[model samples]
Structure formats: structure tokens, C-alpha cells
Target: MLTNYHTLKNLIIQIKPKLIHSQIVEAFTQEKDTLHIIIAGEEASALELNATGQGYIFLRPKFERARKNSLDIFPEIFGDEIRDVLIHKADRIIEILLSSGLKLIFQFFTGKVNFFLLNQKNEIIASFKNPKDNIGKIFESEKKDSNYDLMLSDFNAFKDVWESNKIENPVLRFVKSVDTIDMLTAREILHRAGELEAGRIWKALVDVGAELENPKPRIYYEGSFPRYFSIIELTHINLRKIEFDDINEAIRKFVIETRVSKSYRDEKKTIETKLNELVEKRKRTIEKVIEEIENNQRAQQYEVYGSILMANLNLIEKGLEEVELVNMFSEKGEKIKIKLDPSLSPVENAQMYFEKAKKTKASLKIAQERLERLKFEIKQLENLLDELALCENFDALKKFKEKNLEELKKFGIVKDKLVAKVGGKFKRFIVDGGFEVWVGKDAKSNELLTFKFSDKEDLWFHARGTSGAHVVLKTGKRQPSKKAIEQAGSIAAYFSQARTSRLVPVVVTKRKYVRKPRGAPEGTVAVEREEVIMVEPKLPSEEIE
Candidate 1:
């Protein structure tokens, strides 16, 4: 509810336990001739001035403690003529009230005065009014004694009624007590009490009484209620302090996790490189050993062939010795063969050579097979290492490890014991108990907060008629308080263009009312059956910290 005139009036009536203090420090006239009244107590104010030349009435409080220089009221209406007149009249009234400590001072032209009285709450109560001829009479009748006591009669009436009298303000007292009496009935009573003689003023007061019944808090511009301004009460909770601690913790955890993952990735990469280098070195060594064995085998084969040729030569030499007579007839044709040494005889040499060759072949085959198996084993190791390298980081490694663990259960590689963070760092939890509120920083985040995370029962809020981040209150099973709603609304307003605005309008609705059309952009949604709250954005104390 924007604090329009009607709403302000309603609030005043509802919380009618204390003094109503209205200080109009400034005013503005819109192009539509509506008067905007900026009050000090209220964050923002507005009023509509009529197009007609006649001006509106404004009433102010007259208090005893008011200083001579305290009233700095100014008229900010459109025309210089009326503006000058209003400024002059306000100055005169302030002067009179300051000098005489008058409880009521009338602006004769506008037919309004400053009224001050005490309420049940012992708070200063005040309002604006038109000067009534029967005001003295009304004041007299309200008092038991006929003395001309201003404070003792009007202000003290509420305080003196009961020891713990709750009706301390005059307006509240009047509203609460005078139920049966009509306006005329009360006027007649006042007429007789003070012996008022001015009929015209009395009639005007009677008309003012009607206006006060449902007083819309507005600035009077051109003698009429052109633009109505209201006062809206915004209730909010202080959750920034609580959320700040949680967010800090979340950020800390996120940073730690990120660092750890990066470190693990770096370490894994180093291990993979070292393992690959070792495997390649082992493969080259095995290949060299196989080549050496092949060379040794070829050398043994050549030795066997030499041994066979030497054995054949020894047999030819023995035959030549027996046939010496034939050599004389054919000396040119005779083959001269030298006898081989007995220590290097053919049979003994062949046995020695065969044994060496057999032994060499056996050893070479065994070494080659062993080398081949080792190379195959190394290849398998390299493949496994390659896979491990692709795991990227600890998070991925952990997932893979977990999966492998399940598989390893069949082979019994290790026992099962899972230890890991169950949720991500960015995951949100409830604050102020189990209210599922989600906050986001931007449009994309807002979309994620509402559509992706928020439940149907959650309520959504945003600054109305402006761009703002979306805020969702997760009302799981609990009813939201006025304070909580206000706090969320403040967040929505604070993150919006209207953050600097005096009073920002925030629209809130249940999640059910919010809908996203097909193919709509992020954070774009339609809503129905929502409430509007106007509030000044107040940053949490913790936020400043």
C-alpha cells in the first residue's frame, strides 16, 4: 500500500493511541496541479492542488515546547502569488504560536490551525485544523472545571482519567468516547459550554468535523482535496546481520574448495607425467635386451658351421696319407689336406658347439618372451595412467573413485566409506527459522532463484514500477510476519533504481501468482493478487560493516 492520503488516515485511526505530529518541511506542485507535501516524519508525502484559484487548508500542531525558530514551514505551490501569501501566513501563525504557546492557531484565509494535545501513550499528539468558534466551548465542556486552563484541561484530561490511562491524546479520546453524539449534538454541547457567539465560525468547524472523520493526510493546494497523500507503515525485520555471517561462511568454503580442487589437478598432472616417463624408459631397455640376444644367437650359429667344415677336412687328410703312390702319378691333381688337431676333433667340437647353440637359443627365447610380456604390461599401465590424467580435478576424481569403489566391491580392492560434502557451497538455507527465502543479485540470478530453486509456496517480492532484483520468501509452513515481509521488500527496493527514492513502491505476491510465459526472457513474469508496500530503503547495519 503506497502511503496515500486515505491509507495514512486509516493508519492514524488504527494506531490512535498517541500524538500525531505532522511537519511539512517542503511541498511541490505537479503539472496536474496536485500538491506534494513532504513531511519530516513520513519518508515521503504528496497532495493535489486544485486548478481553481482557491487554496486548500493545512493544520499544524501547537506545542508548548515549540521554539520561536523551530517552525520553518514553507509554501511550495505553483503560483508565486499564492506561494508568497502562504509563506507569509505560515510565518505569522508560527510567530503567534511561539509567542503565546497557543494550542491552536488559525490561518484565517485557509481556515486551518495547528492543534496539539496529549494521548493515552503520553506522546505528543498534534494535527492541523480550521479555527472553530465553538473550539473554546468544546474545550470548556471537555474539562470539569470552568477555568481557562489550556494544558491542564485539554492535555491533562487523558493523563488524569485513570492511573494507567491509555487514552492520552485528545483526538483518540474524542474518537473513543464520543460514539453516541452526532456532530450537531457535540456542537450544541460546545456552544453552551463556552458561550460562543460566532455562528459562521461554528458552522465552519462543524464542516471541518466532517472532514476530520476520515482525514486523508494530504497537502491542500487550491482550497480542495485535489491530490490525496497517505502514510503507509512499513514493517521489516533485521536479517542482513544474520545472512551476512552465513554468506561469509559460504564464500569461505567456496574459496577453500576451489583452491583444493586446483591443487589436486596440478598434483595429478605431475604424477601422470612421471609415470609416463618411467614406462617409456622401461620399454626402451627391454627392446635393447632383445636386440642383444638376437646378435648372440647369430654368433653361435656361425661357430657351428665352422666346426662342420673343419671335421670334413680332417677326413680328407687321412685318405691322402694312405694313397701316397697315387699322388706321385698325379701331383697336380692331388688335394693337399692337413690333419686337424686331436684336441679340436670333429665329434667333440660338434657336441660342444651344439650345446652352446642350444643353450643360446633357449636363453634368447625365454628373454624375448619375458621382454614381450613386460612391454605388454607397461602398455597397460600407460593406458591406465592416461585415464587417470583425464580425471581433471579432485571433484571428478572423487566421483570416479566412488564409481570404481562400487566396482571394486566385487574384486575387494577396498572397503566402502564415503566422505564428501553433501551439498554445494552456493546452496541456500532458511534463516529466521524455516522460512525458505531466496535472494539473488541480478536478473539471471533472480530467474534462478525463483524458477529453479523456489517452491510454489514461496512468496516473491520486487520493487513495483521499477527494475529490481527478485526476492523470494520461502514460507514452508510458517506464516510470514509483517516485519519479515517489510525486510524482504526493503531488499527488493534497495537493489532497485528506486533505492535512492524517498519512498519506493514494492509489490509482493505468492509464488503461485507469479508466472513466466513461454519463451520469455529471464526474470520476466506476470503476477496477480499481490500487495504493494511503499517503504524507504534502509540498509542493514551489518551491511555497512
Candidate 2:
């Protein structure tokens, strides 16, 4: 609750904050919409103030260490030192004149709590709600009222004032006559007196005064959450009461316990949830890329089948359903059964097979490019998530966000930036010929190895006609030896689906011939000017020097 006239009067007397000229070390926000000030010296204490309709001003036992950011306006006003603290008579404004001849007015006037710092000339210097922005007019001074004179315990003194007042409404008249009494305080007294009539009003007023003198500050909680705070014990027995010896503590407890803190916690949760979803999505994309790679490899077989059909066309006849032909491509002239369309002639059937092969080649190139891009995106996201997890406070989180805005934007965490960072170092190995070879553990790394990391002079290898890692051999000064090429081929073959095969065909070529087509996925690439070498699939043992 805001310091009503009575409460403010009592606090001024209790605190007795004078012009000791102590230092104002820091001013910042821990909870959202709350300003905290640390005053050091003889009166070394922290002040917490909030002005968002339910605003309250109170002293906290300990400073909120988890400050999100330092207040830009506070430093300009106080200059790290305070000269004097004065409360206007019967007004809820704290006038703090700094050592620098600047005046800071903290007005707790029941709306948004606003701070105005004025120069010696009384001109606005800087403010939380800067006057230059035209948000609202800042007053030079608050209008003060006559201080309440009657002693709190004296019932006869209140009786004389009530009798003299001509106002009709008991509550309204009580508030107008007395400087210190607030609406809630008046209602509380009336409720306790069990009557709204003038006769019972005196008794209620006396009770309220006595309660205010020895305030038993309590916070009322509904369903295990704090709802409101009161100076006296509340009448609601159904609600739980948490008692505090100090009124400031009670107010601090109520302010800290809010939905705003919960929302910040929820925001952290949302970021984590989004990170997990991105990781899962990357995994699915990798799987799809692998499947596409395998399909394209099988499509390569279509080209071989078409060639065999064309060669044996002389023996083929129209209306023939099927034929057995010799496979010239194989080591042995292996007999293969080829299905034929009875309606089409031999030449037409051969042309159809060639057309089918051409489409598969085009699709393979596109899928490879798409696979490469997805892998790159996934790597960047993983790095971004690592940075996110390190953020302990909102300030740190905000800084991280500022630094990695583009990365977060790609994953839909922030606004869309439509950009990406692709590729990173992959696992490396050295062959007997002293050539360093890189092996990709995942789709993204594979794309990096083939298209980004390796130079045009370097060699590239992958398992022929199958899904495998894209391996890069760095031949800096000399051409890679036969042993090095074979070893690299083995590494590629071992990483492929044909790892179990005793002998697997691996396609090896220079990096210049490895091309990433537009819109291809991660780990998919088109190889040209390639030479196929058959080797037993196995992983390289020696680490790169």
C-alpha cells in the first residue's frame, strides 16, 4: 500500500532521515516496474518503490542483488550521493536533494510512481518518465494539508472534530477532517465499530488510531498466494495471514510475490522448450536427408539397367513381354531379366528408360543441396542454445539475445532475419601418406567437409551408389598417394550403409568436382570427374597430426 498521510507522517517521524550527506551507491530494478535504491553511510539502507496503481514505498532489509539493469535516470539525479531526504508535510512525496544540487521527487501519488530530478534552477534534468517525452506534466511541488493534531488514542479529541464537521457522509467527513486517515483505514474502523452512524464513528476512529500506532503488518493470502497487505489484522478468517514485525518487510514480500516474476520464469521455460523442438526437428531432417540419399543411390542403378537394355536391343522383339540379357557392366556376363512393355517398340522403351534416369539425376542434385542447408541451420541452432543455457539473469539473457539475434531469428525465437551460418570443423584423421582427411559425423558436418572447409585442390570421397559421409583429404603440397586415397575411401565406405560389405565401391574425386546444387539438403552433393575404387570398409585408426 502507498504511504497514506497518517502512514507517511508516522514513517517520517520513525525514519528521521536527515541531511547526513550519505552516498547513494546504486539504483536499479530487480522486480519488474520496481525501483530499488541503496543508500550507504550512517543510514545505510535500501529503498524499494513501485508506482503502478498498487504502488508502495518501503525499506528492504537486504538489497535485491539480481538487478536486471542499472537505472539510467537514477545516476543522472543522485550522482552516487544523496545530500538530504525530506518528506513534504502530509504529502506522500519524498524530496531527495542530491550532493550535486539536483532534486529528485519520488511522488507516491496512487498512480504510476514517477521520479523527477530537477537542477538547482528547478528545471527538469532527467526523469524515469522524462518530461521532454510529453508523457504527462510534472508538478513543481505537491499541495500539502494541515497535519492531524489529535492524539491517536484520545477518543474525546476525535469526538469533538466529528461533532464540528457538517459533511453528510460519515466516511467522507472523517477523511476531510483528518489529514492522516485513508479510505481503507476509515472503512476498517467503520467495519470494526459495527455501525456507519455518527454515534459509532468515534469508537471506530479510536480503534483505527490505536491499531495504526502499534501496526501489526500482515499479508493476506488466498490459495497460497498473497492477495493484499494491511496494517492491522484482516477480518477475513478464510484467507491465510502471514505476519511480519516490520511493515516494510510485509510490503516487500507482497511486491516480490507477483505474476510478473512468474512470467519471466515462463519466458525462460519457453526458450528451453523451443530449443528442444529445434533439436528434434533437426534430427527428423537428418533422417529425411539420409533416406533421400539412399533413394538417389538406388536411382543410379536405373542408369545401369537402361544401358544393358540398349546393348541387347538387337535380340529384342516387339510384343515380347520380357527378356534375359547379359550384363556387360558386371565382371562376369551375368544374365539379367528385363521387363518390357508389349505395346512400345524396342527403341521407344530404351528412350523411356533414359528419360527416367535423367529425372532421378536432377532430383538427386536438388536433395543434396537441401540436405546441406538444413545441416548448417541445425549446427548454428545448437551453438545458439549453448549460449542461451549460460544466461543466469535477465540482463545476461538480453545481452545474449542482442549478440545472437540473427541466429535466434532463424529458429523463430526472435523476429525473422532470413540468414544462416553453415559448417564447422569435423573429425580429422591422417593417412600413411601424411595427408589429413576429415570425416563428417553428421549431415551438416558432411556438407561442411565437401563444400565449405575443403579447398578445390583437396580430394573428396564417398561410398559409390550408397549413402555415406563426405570425406575430404587435404593434399597441401603433394598429390595424395594410392595408400592415402584407399584409406580415405575405406573411411567413407565404413561410414556408409555398406559398412558390413567385405568390398564396397567408393567414388573419389577432387574437391573442385564436388558441387552443392541450389536448395539441396545437408550431406547431399553431386560428384563429377569421379573414379570408383573398391575397398574393404573400415575406419581409420591414426589421429591427424
Candidate 3:
């Protein structure tokens, strides 16, 4: 655990950076509490730190070695600015003073590991955790050098303070005494002495306190995983002590490994969340589009009014702003109101209603077509979501990210990239007789398979008068056997709307006969010279490679 006081002390010594002042090249946040800071100097190094829990500080490798995409969440505060790296002589905090006098403080104390970047006027700039309560209210003024000293004089002062005050918690009392030791080290000292009272553990505490003056860093591990690191030798028998010439190297490897694992988990969570949100939003869009199409269809009533006005021209007079006439199309012959333009003649007004009816009919057509396109897009997004669910490793997730990130960018789910087209590949299946059959997974794939990938002579099959995949059988310019054609028909039927039907009719034709009309929706096509076959919707029993 990096919260140990001795651990931070050893880490600072091990780093021993030659340059105290360096420019902040960039800063990238892996998650909410973890970040990577790049400092440029004669020998540049990237420093990694986590503040939420199990936090550690180490010299990380270059940006290329980073496993996840680097997000510039806070680009304005930490980029290309010179900062003074100040490791306080005291063991509690590491401060990075910026050119603008803002100090980025990394406090590595137990139960309160946090990062706080504060302005020169002591106002908080940015923090990792609860800034108002956890950081701002609790920060105490720095004590004198004598208070932090681990020698006999400071020990006497702690002894006087302990005797005069009535503190119940032993760990809190120890912190007030030494002003630098954490709870873990305090508990370790008491455990080594086999005592709970302060008086009884005095000798062991002094010995451990003296070791802090001359540090010997050691990392404790549990079965190849780093569990705890400290300057004093660990007392537990189960833990294996890993000795390192430089503790910085040890902390670096351990923190990097932990970060790599956490980064993937966070990335996967982000993808899953975006996919879920898009699915829900697209569903709402489809519903709203359908409602709009229905409203446009209701505008067909404009035609009936125009017909009524034409039938009752004698009832209208010159300069009549409005008219009341029987709606002949209605079964009850109800009187309807027809607003008129006083400047236009009765005939021209009737023509105006006729023109409005025509425009409404055209609007209805456009709305229906738009609704179909929206539904197709929803289907495509659902297919993409299924593929994301099957992403079991980093490489799969990475490919999904690279391909579908632009789709998410449309909704501002991921905003740092240009728009690009993405879709799942076609599903391939092997049928009997060693023939290869390809099935379209979605609307886009259907068009791709039928027009772009399939050969002119290849046999194509689809469920008759229904929405389904375009199934292509690779005939290789040779006529397939009756069994292969029948099997392909079954696959085509199974992927269609009639999948549950006892018998489905599938239309079979050559690829050259399937022509997509200009500006048509995906997967829609006109067929010529088609042959219909009746088959039960089912998968082939045995598929060969």
C-alpha cells in the first residue's frame, strides 16, 4: 500500500531526479482518480498517480506503452507549463508548483490519499476527491522542522503531548506525536513489540522510528502480486519480501500493472454505457418518427375539403373570408368550416385547397420514407450492440472502439474524432457439399453482399415478400446440387419474418437479376427471373468448413 509513510519516503529517494524544474508536457487521466503526468527535461519521464484507493506514485514508461487511450480531461491546467517539483523535507506530501504559483499537492497519508492543486492565494483549483470536505477543510498548516524530526528531541515533545492530552485512539495519538508516521507503520510497530499500550510499545516504536532516518525499502508480495511496500522489514510470514535496488522501479512496475487492468475495465464500462444509451434514444426516435408519419397521413382530410368546396361553389360570394358547407364525403353530411382568402375568387380558393392537399400528400410520402430509414438505422445499431457484448478481451474492445467510436461521436458520446462509417461484417456459414453460404447480418450488410461481394452468376435467395437477410450461395459458375440449393433456401427462410412458420416461401435468383433502385433503402431490391421454393425455416444439420 502506498499510503505507508515509509513507502513514500523511500520512493522519493529512489527517484532522485536530476532536474527539480521541468515543463508539464501533458497530462492524461486513465480514470476518475488515476492520472499520468509527463515532465520534460534532459531525461523525460511520465509519472503515474492514483488518489482514490491503493494509490501509488512511480515513474511510468512513455505514452506509447500506455494500454488505453489517453484522455485530456483537464488540458488547460497541465500542458506545456513549467512547474517546480518540490518534495518537502517532511514525508507527507509532494508539491508541484506551477509557473502561475498554483501548487499541485499529492498527499500520501493513510485514509486520506488525495491530490489537490491549489492557487497561490490558498484557493483550491482542482482535486481528485471531495474537495470541500475531504481536502480543503482538513489541511493543517505546516509545522516547524523540529516537529517533523524523528530524533530524540521530537520524541520527547511527543511524549509530553501524549501525557498531557487524553486521546483514546492509539493511531491518532501516534500521528500527533511523530507528525509523519501513518497508521500502517504505527500498527506494525505495536505488532512487533506485541503490545497495545503506548508505554509498553515505546522501545519498539523508537527502534522503528530510528530506521526511518536510514531507510531500507522492501516490497511484500502475496503469490507474485505486490501487496504492501515499506521501508521497514515486514513481519508477516505469509508475505514474500521482494528486495529491489531502487524502490521506484518496484513501485513503477506494480502501479503500471494495476493501471493496465483498471483501464480496460473502465473502457469496457464506457462502451457498454454508450451502447445502452444509443439503443434507448434510437428507440424513442423511431417512435416519434412513426407518430409524425401518422400525423402527416391525417392531413389527407385537406383533399376532402377541396372536393366539398368545388361541389358547393354557388354558396360562396365575392370577398367572403369564410364559408360553411356540407362535407359530402362524411356519412352524416356534417357542415365544415373552410377559411378563405378574401382577395382570391371562389375558384382560386378552391384551387388553393387543392394545392394544399397535393403538398400534404407529398409530405406524407417523404415522412414514410424517412421513417423506414430511421428504423433501418436502429436495426444496424442493435446489431452493433450485439457484437460489443461478445467483446471478451482488449483487442476485441479496441477494434470495436476504433470502428464504432464515430457512430457514438454523432451523439457526442465520444467527441474527439472525425465521423467515419462502421458496421459489422457478414456472417459466414458452411453448408453441405463443401459449399460456402454467406448471410447478411443487417441492412447494410445485405446490400454489400448482394451487390459488391457476390459474383454475377452466384445464386441468391431471400424469403418471399418479407424482410430478411440476403443469403448468397457460392456456385463458382457451376450448378449446385438440389440439396445445396434446398439448404440455402432453409437458411434464407430462417433469417426472415416467417422464421416460425411451418413452411416459408423463398425466392431464388442469380446475383445479376437483383438490382437496387436509386436512393432505395438498404437491403431493398427488384428481382427478375426468380424461382420460388417452399422449405421449413431451419439451419443446416451439419456444416462443413
lDDT of each: 0.44, 0.71, 0.71
Q: Better model by TM-score, 1 or 2?
A: 2
- Deviating ranges (above 4 Å) for candidate 2: 8-14, 17-20, 26-32, 42-44, 61-71, 76-83, 99-101, 133-138, 146-183, 259-444, 447-545
* For model 1, the run of ten residues with the poorest summed lDDT: 81-90
Q: Model 1 over residues 127-212: C-alpha lDDT tens digits? A: 23322332333331112332212212343442233223355543343323333222233343344334322333234334444544
lDDT of 3 by residue, 152-199 (tens): 345456556666656678767666666567777877776776855545
lDDT score for residue 370 of model 3: 54
Best by lDDT: 3
Runs of candidate 3 with Cα error greater than 4 angstroms are 14-16, 28-30, 64-84, 87-91, 97-102, 109-177, 197-200, 260-445, 448-534, 537-545
Clashes of each: 29, 12, 0
Q: How far is 492's C-alpha from truth in model 3 (Å)?
A: 3.5
In terms of TM-score, how similar is model 1 to the real structure? 0.24
